[model samples]
Target: MAELQMLLEEEIPAGRSALLDSFTNLERVAEYCESNYVQSPDKHRALEETKNYTTQSLASVAYLINTLANNVLQMLDIQASHTSLLLFL
Candidate 1:
C-alpha cells in the first residue's frame, strides 16, 4: 500500500508535466501555422475540432488522476485509523 501510494504520487507530477509539455507543443505548432500559411475553412474547422478534443481528453485524464488520488488518501486514512485503534486496544 505504501508503495502504491508512492508510485501514484510520483505519477501525478509526471502526468502534469506531460500535459504541460503537450500544451506547449500545441501552442508552438499553432504559432508556426499562423505565421507560415493561410488555412482554408475546412482546415481551420479541423484544427478547432482537434484542439477541442485534446482539451477534453486532458481534462478527463486530470479528473481521473484527481479521483484516484482522493481514493488513495481515503484508503490510507481508514487504514491509519484502524491501525491506531488496534494499537489502542
Candidate 2:
C-alpha cells in the first residue's frame, strides 16, 4: 500500500504535466491551422483532420488523468478505512 501510494505520488504529477503539455500543443496547432486556413482555403480538409486528431488525443489524455485520479482516490479511501479499523481494534 505504501509503495502504491509512493508510486501514485510520483506518477500523478507526471501525468498532469503530460496532459497540460498536450493541451498546450493542441492550442498551438489550432492557432497555426486557423492562420493558415485564412491564407489557403484548399487546406481546409487537412486542417479539419488535424483538429480531429488533436481533439481525440486530448480526450484520451484527459480520460487517462481521470482514471488515475479515481484510482488514487480509491486507494486513499481504502487506507482511511484500514486505519479506522486498526484504531477500532
Candidate 1 residue-wise lDDT, 1-89, digit = tens:
67556645775566666666766766766675564435555777666766776676678667766855775677677678879999999
Q: Alpha carbon lDDT of residue 8, candidate 1? A: 57
Best by lDDT: 2
- Determine which window of 10 residues in candidate 1 has minimal summed lDDT: 32-41
Candidate closest to the true structure, highest TM-score: 2
lDDT of 2 by residue, 5-68 (tens): 7646876666677777877877777787677777776786867867787778778777878867
Q: In candidate 1, which residue pairs clash?
A: none
**All candidates' TM-scores?**
0.53, 0.64
Write down the TM-score for model 1: 0.53
Model 2 error, position 84 (Å): 1.9
